[model samples]
Target: MCSFKLRPSKLSRYFCENLKIMQFKNTAEFAKKLDAQDKLASYKDEFIFPVINEKEVIYFTGNSLGLQPKRSQKYVNEIMNDWGGLAVEGHFKAEKPWWDYHERLAAPLAKVVGAKPEEVTVMNTLTVNLHLLMVSFYRPSAKRFKIICEEKAFPSDQYMLASQVRFHGFNPEEAIVEVKKRDGENHWHLEDILKTIEEVGDELALVLIGGVNYYNGQVFDIRTITEAGQKQGAFVGWDLAHAAGNIKLQLHNWGVDFAAWCSYKYMNSGPGNASGIFVNEKYLDRKDIPRFEGWWGTKKETRFLMEPEFEPMPNAEAWQISNAPVLSMAPYLASLSLFDEVNMDLLIEKSKLLTAYLEFVLHEIDVELGETTIFEIITPKDRGCQLSVFLHGQGKALFDYLMKNGVITDWREPNVIRLAPTPFYNSFEEMYRFGQILKQGILEN
Candidate 1:
């Protein structure tokens, strides 16, 4: 029963049309049949899953932290071996010289984020990078000092925005404007966001929102929103923490001023892995722009001279405040290599089908339970790999039961569970199995 107007993208239209006509059966055989036909089926063997009670758990928390790729060990060992043998010399002598190691990720990561190679660079962690990017994009004046964001944003973002406003001697209450969802609604409307931007008009300094809402899995219209913000003479940036590798992005084409995303979630790097950033090509090599400078952000040709003047790199790397964390970046490079092999388009196609199948399975389980639907899929049609479900007439005991039964999911406050079936490793058979387990948990409790 999930239905919404498809976005203008051809992939979205194709996905929506196929989803409407696709029939699903609540059987293991049917699940296996679908998996057998999946073009990305073999990619599942590339990841490592945890086992509990002698069975591999059905992992559905990729939105929180993706499973590790097997190749991550090899990548990590390369760095370790070089450091053990060559020490300081390893900076220049390693197979992938440590000094320029992060440069290898730019091209592939660019493809995933739909940016030019020079516009993207791997850098510090998520919130840290956001703070750094804000140093440049959030320049506020007395007339245009207000920032706009979504209501109920991630806690880290709330803290970051508040601190930024306070640092500039502005009160958070007066400087920050949050666009709220409709009464009793889980998702945001595109028109409401656009209207807010219009109303904010001349006073808006910046518009920064999570491209994909972490809590509800809603995918906002980035291109439209970015244009609206810019029209009002405000800079636009995105926190792509959940959207980076989960959906198709065109930061460059979208004319986004800046963006930052962690690789730990959909990118499948490691826990708190290095973050990647995108700065529009227009901002590159601009000496007039404001940013915090560091040695690593300098041009490589003159970096060895240790000059007194801060000569920034002619690309997004200028935002980097410190030398690359080689250890943390190793796993990220490994994950990006896998991304290069599969490409975002193929993964997205599979994701559409896989997520639709999961939705169908949830509906089947609800039908089996009773006339009153106990499960409400709060996530709207404009979503990526995640579905946030509100469990009506359910409690934490049901979540605990599922966890004990080997279905790993993320539980939110009140009564909600976030399920993300990543295209890389999640299978249709697992989706079918999860539905069975979910039914058992509810009935037993």
Candidate 2:
């Protein structure tokens, strides 16, 4: 379980010495060799990838919803047994008390998002947590009354921002600043984003951008963006729904004021699992911050006293609006335990190599077909497991064909196919096969 920690010089040397010999190829034999050399290869068996027609489906939709962990059932059964035996006493007396269950998740989740244990907490769904954090962070005064966000942010985020502005009696159109890519381009350039931040410097009350652009799969420079927004005297937050568990983050180190992400994506938690939130430790004791709080957020010592005066916990847990749903959280624990063992440093390195292989295979398809007619990868070089491929034409038919052939990729509106090769469960062999299928698909279409 030791992580591969190498300095830049040594890492380069290691790559040249070890990885150069393992050159990526479009053949199945090369895929096998890569898989054989993969230290994380054994991890693929930990999850239950979907099977269809007596064959294992090429499940590449982890960016949408990750496959289930085998230990999830065991984790849930423990809670179920506690409910059946201890009943109400399970809150205090169970093996892992339901009352303090969420606390157990905080430390491991902190590692995932690169935050202090006191800065992160697992609680409500992503949108709910986003809105809750906004109630505290989106404090717009007379001069700073605008929010700068991405134009192509998730639909729920767009709706949430609009409603938040409207709730404050501000016109959504006037108070919300949306930054879009240049015409004819799918990815956002860093210079353009920095320019926009400068343009809205004075009026920007908040800057809430997706850590990774979901549609185009572009990873943003969080530290630089946060610094830029802060220089403009604006609170900086992140919607990490598409970035969490897939990419390495430093929410606290980067001075990200707050962030929220769903656990079901690359986290490998069950569907609709509890979301995690990070509130920087600098704001931990800011009693003036207006958060939507509840009993669960009160200090543990006096929480049972119910004295009517809310004494909030001196950590990110103070933002909790209600007691966590233990059932929904159990499976997350099972998955988090695995992350703790394997660690993000290793996972992130493996992810880069695996996705690079996918990209290589895709290019090979273009060459094999002797045409640029297949599809174009819109995802940038710096990305996580997911790659967004823009289909040339009649994408629905090709998508349907892929689905029927047991390739489970995600299709967005219009003509984008998102292929996510989860490092935890997906294999190099699958990437090679997908390239072959995609070439066949393009030719048939």
Candidate 3:
């Protein structure tokens, strides 16, 4: 059912025509034609779009922050009503009470990551969860102290790993091993990574990587990477901020030791919502892993006994340092309910088609523009939802122009422009409009 037909894209026909007068009519026709055949067209109604200058802007910035669902307001209202009605007793007295709310997010999150229910828990923000995971997993000593990560990871993740190394009484310069692409290589070589693990089998302590890279949109082979790290006696963790809802991940089967991700990107939760964490169920009974404990981490049945002694919960819940933020969680609950309704398998089928169509359309535009075109897609072939395009040298100018025209895609510093066509809410018509805007932006700049 996946079709890769390129019938004159809306943006292409609009701006590149010699007949300036007929362009508008041609574009309108092309847009509607694409929409008529669009498989995921009905999904457009699911999201809230920003209206600019009496027109709805084409939103392509799901990588930065996804649009909120309409149900989020009602979800938050119920939580607010519970707070107003029950006050201190709302933790146990209300419908969808505070006590079990964190657990409510776990099963859906587990399905997203291919984790067991006991292995995944809704917890802190992405970087915060990363640091908390390091507290328990990053057990470095004199011999094995270095952590391996990508050279161009999200700046926050880089900072977290550096600070974590320094906190463990090690210089980041010496303790953090940054795996970069070889000279003249545009992307990382998996063989090189496997070789590095083999070479440093004794000295490596931890392996952390973005599940799907934020800048280049490279979906790393997580299972192979995790196996290589574990073979080197390194604890492997993934920052799944971009990958959590965008791709199908087998976090447990991959033998990933720990992972963390935010909900605001493709997950469609509101900004700064509570994130999820994954701890392999193998660690469920292993008390040797040191954890920073709190009352919430204590056994739930005896938590109210107010004993100073911390008896940690049996599973990933033991990692919880405090009670959750109910307001933030309400948005995730709203978004996650949508996921449960439409399973990841079905969403992934739609995602591949959506992104493939975007790529096909972009490439077709390039071909029409002749040999001087400079846009280069940096994302790998196997990536999910997002495509990172490098505009040779005009990244900023093109990006500014696109923003000026009310097309909202994100630009990484220096070059790349990242556009994510999320499966749940993005439409083929929107992709058509975006491609049209992109062509105009590039031509004008």
Candidate 4:
């Protein structure tokens, strides 16, 4: 048995408690034994995997794009069939009416992100939804025009924030305050984030950050940061592209003003699927809020009445500018069905142990290599399943070797590889196999 120091969380506690009594072995038989005992072992069959060299590739890129659910085709086919048979009547005649198809995902997505059903809605893509959320939340005045965010956030987020400040007639360099990581540190410290928010003080109008960083896979303290920013009289929101289905969130309980996430990642929807947004209940049905209106966002009673006055929906759907993309949302709904079967609590529990096992296997491979470890896992313990490993004394040749040998991983510029072993489809056996493949790749290179 080994003592693992993980970030403080309910899931981490569970992982540590189990680790204290169980020994981790770096053998194929041990991996199979663990998989045999896995409750979600059958879930691997639910997703479609790419095969290379006559074997299913070990996928470790769920942080970027999740594997497609096998049922997704059925969902998409239903939409296609409805569109073909009913034509214009599909809006109301179809089994799942096209008009309110997006509504099907609201409840399940709310559970995954820890929000009220009314607080969540499926709509535009990730960046688009963030921009829309900023329209209502990022209110800037002469005295309160500054925004605080993590340094080197996902490039799309950086662009959105910059464009937002500029749209409000403020220079980005002066209005945007980025909380920088300490020298030689891979992750941001919570104290630094709160301190920056405090220092910005009255000038801070908005605090928008990624709940989980894309590069380092660090999970930010969303609740604490939201409270700190709001205490300073600033609106706080999150871009949950990497956090939504990967980590546990309590958006409503945390009192976050607004947030958005893409379903294509950990939610296991197809690539570039529709995004989901969360709006605090306090902000819902408010006539005072600034928003871009559309017919789809109006109240259902008057949506077809052709009224000149815009009557917004009483929930988060009020932020929607147009009709839902049912084709894109079909797969998302399909993926949510799987989530409905396995709640976030169970998924998170499995994630903690699976990621810990992956970490253990990585270390085992490092020990087998030499006295000096050639890998440095940049992702901190305050993370979900993603482990961003920096390869020292190894280059793209190793990455290429892994790809050629049927390992699907995400490669970042310089020399880092992000591996996310999703709780649903990814198995403990794959983690052990990855470690062996990695060692062989290094040796061969």
Candidate 5:
């Protein structure tokens, strides 16, 4: 029951106009109507989707790398223009003030992740920020040193945690606990995670989990888990790379001790653009907490005084070890402006329906193919736009088929494909056509 229309999508390079008010069918016509009804439908034009063989391909890998915003070029150009015209003076003389460029993004980013502006700041890459935060929060004692995380967290996180534990002189096999789903299960059960935390009791010093599992698209109940971990005297934090902009968050209110995320995936801030971090207000004022310090992290009033002593800022900005990379941050500033306008609530609403419709279409495909269905969906109902499709046996060939046929989906090792119907620029009609192409791929295979 996904019906939309296709009336000149006022934002991108998509076709099919004068095709509105149609029924929800398996036909291309139904897909077009669904596109027309989308309030965010027009915004698709603002992005640049890749064209394969002179035809536009259906791009569905937003969970990996998002499409570039048309305005990204303009934003970068403005910075280049300032650099060209003003040279070193641009640091203080530019229209937006490059000296404090990173500060400008704090407010907008706060709105995106649901935190006070002072509690959020753009900083290093995901794992780098994770290491920085762990320095302060991961103070392990002899009686309490175990850190709990999911089994298949992104490789970078796994390495960082293992190293952090090793740096503390603890055996990783005993210090790091990776909670896993039951055998033959696709998604993780929340109760199982809570039980693990409870069993660890006071021995659990920290709980570091991915807000959304990268491979299986399982969205964890962050608030509940944080509460459970805290009840056992564990400091809780989240690796939110896949969850940041894809799902609504309240990191501050959830009492999360700390969290970090990259902006490229869901935030659409170009590859390796910058990462954001959140630290609760309580930790911001405590001088007792240990952290690495740099010139930028010192208070603005004394930052230029060249004083011998280090004085940290009163917020998450204290975590910054260096000045902002203005050029790298330009694309993010451009994208954050868009987030400011549309907001998370509206974007998440469209994402829910769009992904559900995709699930519906895939189930229909499963019914037609009987036991030889294309793939089984591993993502659960609590997910964002991403759906991790677990294919049957060496599915790389099927992945190649989809790619060659103008469908862009993310392929993971073993036998899984990740597809995300991002509300920012993806259409329901694209989902319908993707289903059509998938059906054809299955028939040919």
Candidate 6:
């Protein structure tokens, strides 16, 4: 197994070249051929690809960061030209004005999340928005001061919750309840989650959960969980960084109090791009919620008035603490335009087939090999494009081998590889090819 170097073996090269030609010949020729007939195949050409060794390497890391759209360069260039030509006046004189630039993005993002125009705001990064939303919604009373979250939440969120508790003079270990999956289970049972809520009813103040878990790729039942929390009189919010563009969401109709997500993943925005937040319409009229405010959060019409008093704009905009970053949002606009070409329904349909195809191929290889190859998928079947696979202890070695061979999936710490075939740009062929390479890696090792 250690004999397998980082260099692509002769076997790998032969496999890649033959697979390329065999990619579109027949349905029986694995799923790669199916990509040739895919209705959304044209979408792949819309994005820019980085050339490594003069080849467009297979990219399965979209769940972490999506490939840049070809249009993004043009979009950012336009912003650059505007800023250079108009200087400070670019606030209004430019084509996509700096002042209302963020608003232009809100419509497309709202369309993606199934929210009303006023309910969504493109603002801070995921964890920051989560903290900001908590400032307004996580109002704990003397008796109800506990917060609920997943046992294995993203670390930044854990830190955010800990700090939020300390800010209120409470110990996180005592006041925050982490809902855990049973031993040997990949996901938390809905009944058990509800039971936890029931047991902590009066003490729970907020229930914050990841829409799609970062580690296992489990798409949690947001509506069900939020309903349970609301029944217990707890405020419900979601961290949608993994689910926003990867899965369909109805934050407003689901009756969630708030949600936040970054645009960089399946949304295809660039690295560290601006994120979005959602606030239900029911809170639109409630001005009493304690909030962190700035001039940007003030009413747009009188924003220039510069009054010392902060009168926040209605809905999600009121949550903004600063002006939108112009350059950072240009990529979001470029990515969102691609979404306009293909809506969630079509993309999701393709995604289901793609993921199911991957599962079928992996299982087929496992059966043929007649050995325990040490790869077990840990994500739930109901998950989106991402599939988290657990390797039997040799995780880092396998991950490095896959990267050297250009099968670019992301590895989480300890032992998990996350492979996401983004519906908008990824193809059936890519999934099939990855399975083939992965199978070869296992056998060779």
RMSD (CA, Å), each prediction? 3.6, 4.4, 5.5, 3.2, 5.5, 6.8
Worst 10 residues of 1 by lDDT: 5-14
Candidate 4 RMSD computed on C-alpha atoms after optimal superposition onto the true structure: 3.2
Tens digits of lDDT, candidate 3, 154-268:
9999999999999989999988888888896557878887887787788999999998888888888899999999988899999999998898899888889999999999888
Model 2 lDDT tens row, 23-125? 4567898788889988899988898977766778999888889999999999999999999999999999999999999999988989999999999999989
Candidate 5 local Cα displacement, residue 98, angstroms: 1.3
Which pairs clash (backbone N, Cα, C closer than 3 Å) in model 4?
Answer: none
In each prediction, how many residue pairs overlap at the backbone (N, C-alpha, C within less than 3 A)?
A: 0, 0, 1, 0, 8, 2
Query: What is the C-alpha lDDT profile of model 5 across 128-202, one tens digit per residue?
Result: 999999999999999999999999889999999999999999999999988889999988899999999999999
lDDT of 6 by residue, 1-445 (tens): 0011111111111112112222122134545457766889998999876665677778888888999999999989998999889999999899988988888878888888989989998987888888898998888778999999999799999999999999988989989999999998888777888888999989999999899998888888999999999999999999999998888888878998899999999998999989999999888755697888888888898998888888878767888888889899899999999888788877876776666556555655565566665667888766888888887746587788788787888988778888887777777777667767777887667
Clashing pairs in 2: none
Tell me the deviation in Å of residue 127 in model 6.
Answer: 1.1
TM, every model: 0.96, 0.95, 0.91, 0.97, 0.93, 0.92
By TM-score, the better pick of 5 and 6 is 5
Give the clashing residue pairs of candidate 1, or none: none
Candidate 5 at residue 137, lDDT?
Answer: 91
Model 1, range 1-445, lDDT digits (tens) per residue? 2353322121122235444444567789988998998989999999999998899899999999999999999999999999999999989999999998989999999999999999999988999999999999999999899999999899999999999999998999999999999999999999999999999999999999999999999999999999999999999999999999999999999999999999999999999889999999999998999999899999989988989998999999998878889999999999999999999988988898888878878877887777897989999989999999999999999999999999999999999999999999999999999999999999999
In lDDT terms, which candidate is top? 1
What Cα-based lDDT does every candidate model obtain? 0.92, 0.86, 0.82, 0.91, 0.86, 0.81
Off by over 4 Å in 2: 1-22
Encode model 4's per-residue lDDT on 44-144: one tens digit a residue: 99999999999999999999999999999999999899999999899999999999998899999999999999999999899999988888999899999
Clashing pairs in 6: 23-33, 32-429
Off by over 4 Å in 5: 1-24
Q: Is candidate 1 or candidate 6 better by TM-score?
A: 1
